[model samples]
Target chain A: MSTASVPLPNWITYGLMPLLNLLVAFFISGLVVWWIGENPLEALRLLIEGSLGRGDAIGFTLFYTTSFIFTGLSVAVAFHAGLFNIGSEGQAYLGGLGAALVALALDQYVPWYVTMPFAVMGAALFGAGWALIPAWLQAKRGSHIVITTIMFNFIGAALMVYLLVNVLIVPGKMAPETRTFLPGGQLPKLDWLMAWFGLKLGPAPFNVSFLIALVMAFLVWVLIWRTKLGYEMRTLGISPSAAVYAGIPYARTVIIAMLISGGLAGMMALNPVMGASARLQVEFVGGAGFVGIAVSLMGRSHPLGIVLAALLFGILYQGGADLSFEMPNITREMIVVIQGLVILFAGALEYMFRPTMVHIYQRFKRA
Target chain B: MDFFDIVVSILGSTIRLSIPLLFTALAGLFTERAGVFDIGLEGKMLAAAFASACVAYLTGNAWLGLCGGIAVSIIFSLIHGFASITNRGNQIVSGVALNFVAAGLTVVLGQAWFGQGGRTPQVSGDGRFTPIILPFADAMREVPVIGPLYANVISGNNILTYLAFLAVPITWWVLFRTRFGLRLRAVGENPGAVDTAGISVTWLRYRAVIAAGFLCGFAGAYLSIAQSAAFIKDMSAGKGYIALAALIFAKWKPVPVMFACLLFGFLDAFANFMQGKAVPGIGEVPVQIFQALPYILTCILLAGFIGVARPPKAGGVAYTKER
Candidate 1:
């Protein structure tokens, strides 16, 4: 650890640092669990079991990850367009409402397969519409998307609370939630198919939605890295003036990026409604969209990075509960502290340690 | 007195209600004009409220407690500005993190200090800042609209209320009539230009943030000592965000900003009035509906806009000078 010497490669700088940071995080957290009177090994055991233990745990974990993947992608896409879509939470709520309404309507009028896709499409439309307003304003008026999107989140939350507590309240229920989705509108399960294989013997709660998220994740990679549209989005994100010089339609690119972002966010509700719970409930999104910002940032706004980040977050979320049950007086809210710490470190990584590390590298190189 | 009496009372309540907002909004004007988005205003207010309430409860002196609250909030603001201006961290993330830290730490600290989870011990009446009855208020109570307006609306407020109102005109003069205010505004809009003109961007932003922290401290003290006797957890609620909105809706101008705070304050006062009263002729409105009027109006204002409002160009971006 010389003060100054070597020039570290960019690969090591970006790749190894994150891994090193996570290792350090786990080491500290492990000690924290120990101080609370819980065995570190046992806590680890429970964490693994809770996230990947058997059929049920796997199903729930995968379900949770699916929604996160979409929302993470939502944030990532907007990041590519140089905009921050903090309104993913609001957009997802609109998506949930849209999907729920479609599901309820089709319960009386249409077949299952036909209505299910319609439900998803309806949600996509509403979500896209929600994002376009801020997108348009950003392009035309130089308004910061960051603040506007946050404002939109507030508006969305109020709107959802009002609608759910009023008009969307299923005829007689006192709860502020909508009716359950029709069987036809639900996402199909592949549990029995997995049962044919020896791998399905566990408590994994994996479903078709998980696969849908993976497929979308893959598509996002291709669309972002390989396509011309992705190139335009990237250019615009990096420098709008440069993008204009390159003949890209800057405004159109911005609007389309937000629309895509919103559509992805809308798709997230599918996991909870169609796969996991099959019902529309208040606060159902459970801050998953907000968590998406952390995931996207941690992933460095790359599609592959986002997929892995979502899975990691999903595991921590599921495991946090199991640890709470095993260890008395230690609740799942502790996970929130860990999550916030992770965001703080990730967002301020360079500020936190880069100076010391780089100085040491410079000394080594000179020596 | 009849309708006129009721109207007079409403006017009085609105001014009293607007005091906290007026302070925070003016604080917002200072920081934002210097090109920093103080989304942490709500968090700062909450911290100040907690500190003031606890200190006043312990010391039995409201003035000392108020100063303590302001100092604590200024420290928090410096942390925010330090992280944002020096570290170049994301402003939105920093704001959110500060809010969360404030929310959690306040409760944890309050519980440890007072044995209550999210509340402090109430202070005695002698420890609370009560309004001083001035002859100016009594003498003007009889004049028609202007006299009643001055007496009912402006005269009968705690010491902090007078300071908050005075801040507006002073702020206006500073922003437009003074060198420091001009530099602050120039820094906020474009720090590079300010730096090119030989101004220290970081110093300007830090000062602006400190000023904001001091003002928010007053806002918080007003909430706890002047308005209420004890600090409640999450009492700031969304007032900070509301002030941010008011700042933007005012186009960051001092005079318009005052009107914006008054407007929001009136809506709040009206909500309180409608709680148990029936509309002159129509049946009574639901209390919940009245309670939600401000949030509903915020949503409408958000969705009703034709275009996005522009903030200072470098408002949230950190300025790093190349030596």
Candidate 2:
């Protein structure tokens, strides 16, 4: 049976269905929390307070949101082109390397403004360049994008480890990290904005990258919804054969879509390297690339939805840390379990309750 | 050591390293052959590893641990079948979700039950699988090349290693020879044809998934109890993805799958060997290059440089009869 048997209103389809699914997920997560002998509601309360209660907490949450936004947008763009770009993690890793190279080479000589723009360009170019091989393989060589991207991620990680340990380490340092960037290369934090508003703000990594992420989200919306290239990409996603029949060059669109997708994923490096850490750290991308997949799925591939979803995950990350700290028994892994539950209900089992809901709606309409 | 001795040692290491890949790739073979693309092999293996370790540690019985692993893996496989088959959901999305769930649940439960770094207590003696020496191992040691080969490479492996190799031929027979195998293969190729011929597509697919679960369980058990003696967090470590790559490299055939696993295993062993040793012209090539070789090779192979590899006709598509 098809899911379109009983038509529902836009409000119920978009808003209610997701809400119901989320409630079920949270309920199951609550049972798991209780299984570990902790009060789920109390745990959730602590999570909210930890993530959004104070200025610093909010700052940290926003900082994480910045990373997710870029990666989520990357996945979304690729999705619109009928490509599953799971290599965002690898692309972001290479992007960090690119940003680091530029900052390291020029930080002592140039000012922050000059270094930042060049660093951004380097990251985008490198990230896009890394993604190009997989795209070309998919477009021309008949390789599956998913498998190639996944393999590329491992290769990228190994390459980074080699470079960090043997080539880029500081002269006498033991740590597998690059030399810290000079103050001139560092992006300015948003503490000044808080001060101007006469608000007391703790030192947080929230910086100019957050603003850039927002701007990029808007740009993505315009590009995807309004441009000729966007139309072709969406058409290609919907029906490749039809798009080919309509004179849309399939290979060119695939390459362009992946380039844009990779560029966005690469931009994620700016958050940790330039905005937060001020140095190239190993595994700096963490699991943000994978999280982007969930965010993109939850947001239904819309820019606004992605922004909101990213913020939600930011809360989960920041708040989950606090929850685990408070309830030592509820370890960090439990939080991951909860997040996995959310992904399960939100993605795989998305239409689980749809048929029942649709039947109920039809009956109500008849009455 | 001489070149012959080095080759023997590397070959031994290759067999040891490839056991897990062999099991997982064969598991993927069964599921994919039945038209369900499962990328969650890593997660299932992880969960099974944890479950087996926990049970073995508690009961001090390796056999019981193997049973526990298989049971847990089957439970997960059924959940996957329910989502993709009954609910008609996207198979990839379901597999991915289950993977995340498995990853999360295993660690969470491990911490709750064991309370020691999310690791189960180390099992010793009866709880762990020790190496078994073959009957002719001692006698064959004096036969020059054959003696060293049998003693070094063939003998002294855990029972599961032999089971993994044995699975290759058995899987080949079951997939190509048996009536169930014929129906399973037909379902993957065209479920509608099977349905028209009076076969139940859902039941056949579910059975295929259950069989996959059993193989994955054995792979996980081999990791925790047989190979490592403890369940380390994230112990699978992308071996499932590598196994998937091997499955693709083998083009879904059982005999080629074993060979592909051996190739990957050799690459891994070579990487470990080259870590501190010096090469003639290269003069101690970086270890990372060898470590990255399998993935890089898989990418090149997948790029159609070797040949085009085609999946099952109905793979990854949810089958629903038109009303």
Candidate 3:
């Protein structure tokens, strides 16, 4: 599975390979749909229509894409520093707590503009704080980042449950959630954008946070490609011994990378808390953190690639819902199976067909 | 009411709760020893639980359901082996993807078959594992500590619980004493050496992974058929991760793994016990603290508080012949 065996063009390696993998994954998923007595082509059509055909559907797709973008960037940043931060889920959970605390304290006293910036900073800080311990341990204490992050995820979940149940719940409310934010704390949606363009977009949760996600993605690109720190990080990732020989501080690079990664993951809280829910809730992070890993892998840890991959997953989510609505046999969980197949092909078994593809290309070039 | 009764009841609950953990941790031990890092134990257990419950409901035979669970789990393990071993894929990504696949497929299949919100029909009578009481349990009722221990803490558990305990020692013996164990451990530590010695590293890893599948199958069957009557969505919860943590805490040893599972089990039981109880000084401690204890402890253990724990040398890296 070495890339040096047969040289491939950049476009074929980056573009055609992933597209082919995705096609094969979808083909297998179609078989699964067929097994359940549903038309795979119809299911796929419904999925596309449900996600992209209408303004409201597009809005929802982008809304989901926003969260994925944050988490995906989080994972991608860590990958550059040779770290696998599986704890983004935990970091995002704590980030929501940070945002919730800020909103809770100042929502009644301040305007949305003031509260929103503070909440975003608070989420990033909290998320970074949660990740710092694991990063430090990995850097200084030789702890495996993967195991520590996983442990932190469970710990974060337990901590959230305790806080929500015992302290954060509204008075006399049975549900384990904080009181809803005042109007001042709620983020304005992008409905104004549609209105300004004279497009009648239906009520959608797509908010200003989506714009924040775009800004963050662009910032990540600049951070990774246009900075000295990014050069050091990539060098450390490619070969640790060489980086050490060049006098790059391994520990500092690891911690800084994780902090930025954790901060990006933390920023994901803005989407659900300020934009959609307007309240702090349990399990709000939901599995977006885990999905980010797949997104990062599929995207090749590139910021532009991550956004595209996130949008693809966003389509799966919104369209999967529509699929279930149209076909009774194709339940929501079936879409997850499809997503898993995609992940399997694109991430884990990514190089399964590469050797054959490379061989064919080399032979065709000679001919 | 009394201290003795409390102790007995807590111990009983500990044994019950530790059953699934013990099975999973041991399952993880096999694969990890062979240098395959598997975080998919949770996914495998969930899939097996669903398969077992579905088969048990359909056939009304607990043993057959257990077999069905093992078969499904083995099939999944083979897929994992194919991806990670044969293709030399990223093990962690492969595991995460498998978890998602199992999580999704079980629900989709369960809904397609049972149509009961992704739950199989509840099995009763022979379809479920019944509690087995040891002989002379009635006569021992009048006796003291030993009697209570035997009757309350040890007896009346499903056969799987006993087998789970038995597996710990068996695993210890197999890992330490057998030729296969030597080859497995050697392969994990240095696959190149094993390859040079004319042993097939790939086959050894595959066998270890398949054995892990068998243990995970038992764990899953025990959850659905013995612990509960039917499979529920995400019933494995974080147990698979907990088992992975336990494996790390044990430093990949067999006996320590059992103890780690028991500690986690005791913590879980303690959490349940403190849910409504009030202490004189603290006054109704939050149950979440105790629930979170095992994970926190695992993190601390991994952070070099306990001496540095070393994994197999070639654990996460794919073995390339040229390299």
Candidate 4:
């Protein structure tokens, strides 16, 4: 009667499960396309060509990838600490506000060089501050981080909406957004380098901001693998009691991990403000913080993995816009379907394979 | 309206609002009491709402729609249970994944079904549940205080509301009075000890989760077919999450959970009422204040010490029996 004696299907478990998940996602998306009376394969072809084929599309994909990189790192950091920080969206919003304020306040007084660092730091600090309340509750009071973080996301959104509507209203403007940044506070473009590298063949948003994201990704990789602090944080993630037994300060480590994650989420403002829009725009993060959960899961919580995942997501996002324009009936939100599917497959990978994958990996190491 | 009449009106809305949450929180209570973390309640409710709304729209049969909703919700619950219990995956991740899947797949299917991008057709009132007036309450309106409140708040609610309120007594009887309930509690609190004592831990947990699935389906039906006549994307809107918070804030007791749901329901109703009313100093109170009240209260309750509420020791751990 014991089902434990039954062997698992190797092909279905290890090889075919991921393909099946992708097939399911595509089939569901195809159904949406079919309802709109479009050939699914042709629609997918348009989607691919629109996302990665041309120069303008490539630039746009890179532009979107910048935000994903920061947010993916944010979620990955929290994941390593066994903390699901669903409030990253809220933290990013607060961070955008912080960056805007810093840009405005020091616009006339300081040069671009001084203001840029301070603006980024201000955003990170505000984001960390926003996340600290929920982290403290989880660490000190044993509250469920999932519910508290989600609640905080709503609170953050409300706070931002209230501010944009009332206190932070731009003079002589009716829109629920902040005013444009001063000239000196705006991030400078790498147009000179793009021209030098012959990248001026088409519309390009590639700038120094992308380089900063790459650097940050590398830095995160180093921090997670090469440092004692990273070791303790990862230890706490697996088992806080065991980490405490190993002489790590569980409370301090948890709070620090959450704070750093929020800081990275806040850093996502660099993309929309410093890179693309060059001003404080409303909804600049554009759900990337929430979407970062998918990226983190797909990336297996590694920095390099996240960067690749971000690139793939960026292509999908940029291409989705084109597909929507061409098809008119199918919207860009179909990309969300793909993202959700990726998260499901990655999260449930262990379930599909059971103990076989781990056993196989162990056997390979013995050689 | 007189002051008493205003209080009676507020109580009436509170009961209507609390009904869905009561079902969800009681559903959470069963799963958690049997050591299964029911974070997927939101996903279950959402999927059920979609199923019920779609079926009702197609067939114009409300009862069949309700059954379809429960069946679909039970299917999702089985998936969740299999992953978390049998495969020993992380319960939180599995729940979150379920939420994402429900949200994504519902929208995908909704667009396919209605061709209007993630919304079902407006359901006529005929396909929805109507309030059943209690007989002989026609003359109870004349009595002062408790009588007026009872007639106003308790007499005219939908059948689901009555059933939701009735679930508390049933849950208490099953948990404390019945042997099956005792076995469930034992499995949740200490699966190993229960296993040693010759009870099937898996069966008890499965029954508990199945019961939760049924209750949550009712909650979803109340949302789509009773409270509103149409289904919208992400209509659950974190209410299932708030129900989980209520379950924790009430310390997992069925009676306390009912009161907790009422407290949240009252806050939501009051918030809705306050949107247009211009307070003296506030000058048309900001909508954000009302929108954030329930979440703010949940955060405060969770962060502050309100009598130590401990989860079962084996709550999130999966049981694997040795052969």
lDDT values of the candidates?
A: 0.77, 0.88, 0.90, 0.80
- Pull out the clashing pairs in model 4: none
* Candidate 2 C-alpha lDDT tens digits along B86-180: 77776776777778788888877777777876787898888888899999999999998999999989999999999999999999999999999
Ten residues in sequence with the least summed lDDT for candidate 1 chain B: B298-307
Query: Residue B54 lDDT in model 1?
Result: 85
Q: Which stretches of candidate 1 lie over 4 Å from their true place?
A: A1-8, A19-63, A108-114, A188-208, A274-277, A319-337, A348-352, B5-13, B56-61, B64-68, B107-157, B224-233, B271-310
Which candidate leads the pack in DockQ? 3
Candidate 1 per-residue lDDT over residues A175-223, each given as its tens digit: 8887777676677776775667544624444556677778878888888
Please tell me which model should have the higher DockQ, number 3 or number 4. 3
Ranking by lDDT: 3, 2, 4, 1
**Ten contiguous residues minimizing lDDT sum, candidate 4 chain A:** A348-357
The better candidate by DockQ, 1 or 2, is 2
Interface RMSD of structure candidate 4 (Å): 2.9
lDDT of 1 by residue, B1-323 (tens): 67776787887888887878888988888888887777778888988998999889989999988988899899878878866887777776666656655664566456545655568998877678987776777787777776776777666678988888899999999889999999999998888888899889889888999999999999899888889999988888778877777777677889988897888778778878877787767887645454445444444354436334456777777776752
The CAPRI classification for model 1 reads as incorrect
Winner by lDDT between candidate 2 and candidate 1? 2
User: Which of 1 and 3 is ahead in lDDT?
Assistant: 3
lDDT of 4 at B298: 73
What lDDT tens digits, residue by residue, belong to model 4 across residues B248-269?
Answer: 8788888999999999888778
Off by over 4 Å in 3: A1-4, A196-198
**DockQ of the candidate models in sequence:** 0.20, 0.64, 0.73, 0.40
